[model samples]
Target chain A: MVKEQAHTVSSYEQELDQVRGMLVRMGGIVESQMAMAMAAIVDRDEDAAMEASERDPQVDELEREVETLSIRLLALRAPMAGDLREIVAAMKISGDLERIGDCAASIARRTLRLDAGDARLSPGGLRTMGRLVQENLRRAIDAMSQQDSERAVEVWQSDAAVDELYTAMFRELVTYMMEDPRTIRSCTHLLFIAKNLERIGDHATNIAERVYFAATGEQLPVVRPRGLPVV
Target chain B: MVKEQAHTVSSYEQELDQVRGMLVRMGGIVESQMAMAMAAIVDRDEDAAMEASERDPQVDELEREVETLSIRLLALRAPMAGDLREIVAAMKISGDLERIGDCAASIARRTLRLDAGDARLSPGGLRTMGRLVQENLRRAIDAMSQQDSERAVEVWQSDAAVDELYTAMFRELVTYMMEDPRTIRSCTHLLFIAKNLERIGDHATNIAERVYFAATGEQLPVVRPRGLPVV
Candidate 1:
């Protein structure tokens, strides 16, 4: 009986590991989607944009798989507080990751539209913003994999930089649109892409929070760093 | 023994009902927040904006309570297929609603910014967009309360209208800003508010999907209606 009980505990641990693995995998897909989407804009590659848009279904499928596995474990294992938090975090993080994929797809689609327009304006700080969000996303996923709250906190604190970069991009794009009505169509699309990237940064912070909560069994304080100050 | 079994079942049912009630309650708070935030923009009332921003903490508290209660039920009850879906749906819905509340608070902050600028542009279809989103949100909550998938489907289909309205408003605002550079600051804030409203519509659709999934064991068709087109 003791051996059987030990086997059961190990199975539960296996299930928990599976859920974590799925989340990290989903995060990887999201990161790739963002990178590809940004590449579409930077290189003006419509094919790359189309590829990024197509990749979203893969992210969505992974989210569904993660959710089903997490729910199955909840129903079957009846996890205690620590494992329970991790399972719940898996669900929440996958949801955020799915949204990030959507944002990437949106960016990709906007890039296609920008390419169709004749205004060949510089992307202006957008590449830098994309790099920052991508790094934050990577760190958040790394923290999740290692169960490192400190690493998660670092990713959480870095959202301000992404937001500041986004605000600057917003202003720059608006000026470009104002200077020449011809650029309005393409700049509007760029504006959406910038907003989407900002939102991806927010999602990274969200995943970091989930990691912190799962590891420490406590939510981080409500006082967080702010990038976009109220005007 | 039979009496004890009956009592346990009733208690589980009571817990399920409690989670649903909390979600609807949270939904109500979100709706009120959106309305007040829109009113702040419409009436140029900084007080209303501030009030909406302050109310967000209450929404956050309710979300925490709902999550705690749902997780406790999952751990203690180990619910089977139908009840498991409901519990999972409750968690997902609460997350979406909390985000909607955050979006409303963001709108409120942007409204305050707009008011401070003294440019005082006409809100320009923002009120109509607010009404559409509020109605969609109300229907989603009602569907959850009644377990009505048909109503959820209706809400799901209505998102396209919201997207079209948002696109129109985006163009109008851009034109206004281009016509007079002085209006740029206030118009930018309005643009954010409009985007926030569009996102709330998306959240309502997400909740509707959850309601449908909870009512039917099968997931909805992945080919769903979308409001914001790729472009």
Candidate 2:
């Protein structure tokens, strides 16, 4: 009977381990999608854009898988305390990761549109902003894997930097479009790509917030710092 | 013992009912926020925009409340099958509704920006698009309350119409910005507002999808029909 109980415990641990593995795989896919989308913009590579867009279905599949496993655990195991937090966090993080995938696909679609027009290179600020968001997302996922709420807080704080950079890029693009009306078409797409990247950063912060909440069983403040002012 | 069991069942029902009420309340707040945000743009009412933005904290608070309750119920009751779906659906729906609130706040901020410039009325198509999204969101919340998956599907199908309208509006605004550089700033704000409305419609569709999944115990196709090609 003792051996039987030990086996049950190990199997439960295995089930959770399966979910953790899937979450990491999903995060890796999203990271690649973001990279490919930005590369498509920076390099003007249509193939990269198509690949980024094509990868969304994989992300969606992983999100559904995570949801199924989390729900199964909730129903079957009736997890309490830390285990409950882990399963719920997995569910919420999967949803946020899926949104990041959609944002990447949105960026890829914009790159496709930019390809059809006169290629105005992404302003220098965009690449920098993209790198910031990418790093933040990477760290947030890492924090989730390690159950490190301190690292999650670090990722959350970094979002303000992304917002500041996005605002600067927004002003730069608006100025460019205003100066040369001919650039309006391409510039509009770039503005959207920038916004999508900023939103991806926001989703990363959201994941971090969930991780922190799961770890501490406390909610973060509803009002966060803002760098971009309207107008 | 039988009476105690009956009392326990009644308390469980009450707990679920409390969550249901909070979900609807959150949904109502989101709906009003969207309406006010659009009204701010249509009427150039800065006060309306500010009001809409201010309401977001309330929505955020309600989201936290719903999440806390849902997680507690999940850990304590181990609800199964349909009851489990209802709790999970409420949690997902609240998150989506909070996003819609954030999008509305985004639009409201843009309206404030538009007010700072030469007054430009929202293009004719924007109002039409706003109404369509509003109707879709309303129906989605109604479907959730009634557990009407068919109505949810109706809301899902209407998203394509919103997307088509958004593409037309996008092209129209881009042309306006190109024709006269003076319209660039104001038109950019309008563009963001339209995008926010389109996103609100997307959130409404997400709610519908969740409702359908909850009712049917089956996942929908990940690849949905999208009408707007960026080119």
Candidate 3:
């Protein structure tokens, strides 16, 4: 009976490891989607945007799979404490990653619209801001995959850089609108794109915080940069 | 043994009920805060904004309490299936509500930044958009409190109206900036306030969806309006 119980425990652990692997795979797709969306925007590549948009459903499918697997592990394995937290955290991190995919797809859609000349206004600072936010998201996922709380702490710390970029981006966009009437349409789309990237960054920070909680069982301080208000 | 088990089951039910009550209460405060923030914006009343900002900590404290109670219930009850979903939904819904409170506080801060001179800019559909979004949020909480999936569906249906109003408001604000450069800063703040309220509406919709899932074990369509890009 003891040997049987040990075998059952080993099987549960294997299931958990499989779920973790799926999460990492989903994270990779999400990261690629963001990068492709960025490229689509910067290069005004509609085909790339369409490809990113099409790939969103695949990410969605993976998210659903991860959720089902996590719940099954909970019900079947009855994992305790740390194991339970890991499963639950996996569920939440997948959720955040799924939303990140949504943001990337949304950015792709905006890129398509911009390419169609719905808005051609280019307010400065957005490309840099997008790059910064995308990097933060990528690092946050890496931190999760590595189970490195220290790397997660760095992601948490880097949230301020994203916010700083967003604030400066906002200021620049508003200034452009104030100065050039013709730039309003394009600038508005750019603003929405910037906002989407910033929200993606926020979700990444949320995942990092969850990682810290999963590792240490304590919530970390979520510090916003100076001058920007937390929403 | 049966009698002791009955007593323990009743105690668990009571605890669950208590947590649900606190969540409803927190939702109420957040809804009220959203309304008051809009009122402050429309009336340009700094005092109302200040009051909304101050009430945030109360909501935060309630959230912390709910989190503790939820974790305790999960540990003690080891609830399965529908019961577990309800508890988990409550935790997630409370989190979204807490974020709504934070957004309201953010709107209040933006209001505080706008001096008497800043209030001279034409708000241009912001008041109507704010009202629509706040109504959606209120109905969402009401649906959760009553466990009415039909009402939750209604809340989901109204998301398009909020989005429509947001689009109209965005267009009006852009037109204002085009007509007059002096309105840029005030209008930018107004834009932030509107965007925050719109996001709160989205979070409220998220909670309503969770409530629907908890009660019916089904995922519902997130019906966004047609003609708007799905950002």
Task: Give the per-residue lDDT digits (tens) of candidate 2, residues A1-231.
Answer: 999989978988888999999999999999999999878877778898999999999999999999998888778778898888888889889999999999999888887777355565554678899999999999998998888999998998888888898888888889989888888988888888889989999999999998999899987777666676533
Inter-residue clash pairs, candidate 3? A121-A186
**Candidate order, DockQ descending:** 2, 1, 3
Q: Which consecutive 10 residues in model 2 chain B have the weakest lDDT in total?
A: B115-124
Give the DockQ of candidate 3. Answer: 0.44
Residues B109-203, candidate 3: write the lDDT tens digits: 88877647767565547777787778888889888988889998888777777776777777777777768777776777777777787778788
Summarize candidate 3's per-residue lDDT along A81-100 as a digit string, tens digits. Answer: 77766776787788788889
Between candidates 1 and 2, name the one with more favorable TM-score: 2
CAPRI tier for the interface of model 3? acceptable
Model 1, CA-based lDDT: 0.85
Candidate 2 lDDT over B87-195, as tens digits, reads: 8889889999999999999888887776355565454688899999999999999999888999988988889899999998998999988888888888887888888
Q: Where in model 3 is the C-alpha error above 4 Å?
A: A115-124, A222-231, B114-124, B222-227
- State how far residue A45 of model 2 sits from its true place (Å): 2.1
Question: In candidate 2, which residue ranges exceed 4 Å CA deviation?
Answer: A115-120, B115-122, B229-231
Per-candidate TM-score against the hidden true structure: 0.91, 0.96, 0.90
Tens-digit lDDT string for candidate 1 (B145-214): 8989999999989988999999889888878776776676677778778889999998999999999988
Ranking by lDDT: 2, 1, 3
Best by lDDT: 2
